[model samples]
Target: MTTDPQTLTWFKSSYSGNGGSCVEWAPMQATVTGIVPVRDSKAPNGPVLSVPSRSFAEFIAGVKGGAFSAT
Candidate 1:
């Protein structure tokens, strides 16, 4: 299913604070289509990355586990 990016409500993590290097996601759209629409917070009009719900969940889990940590 296709959705207009402009129509979706995008939000960034509270931890983002005032930093411009953050990512935004459309939770409502994800709930409706099972696809997580992600985009750079600095570029609201830029391209969006559509990730599968399962893949997104795994990515989040890995993040929580520090699998992608820089340290």
Candidate 2:
């Protein structure tokens, strides 16, 4: 499935703070669909990752839970 590219309002994670990690996502878009689109904040026209709604939720949970830094 696809969406109107011009209408997407993407925002970077609040956790990103002042760093240049540059990750962006459209939460409003995900609310309208069952998928979440994520991409580089610096590359609006670049590749995007479309993840299922549930998976996106889990990803956020993991981030909040600090799963990525436990390795």
Best model per lDDT: 1
Model 2: per-residue lDDT, tens digit, 1-71? 39864578989866787667788888888899988988887778887888998999998899889889856
List the global CA lDDT of all models: 0.91, 0.83
Cα lDDT tens digits for candidate 1, 1-71: 38888888999988888868899999999898899999998888889999999999999899889899577
Q: What is the TM-score of each candidate against the true structure?
A: 0.91, 0.83
Single out the weakest 10-residue window by summed lDDT for candidate 2.
1-10
Candidate 2, lDDT over the whole model: 0.83
lDDT score, candidate 2, position 21: 71
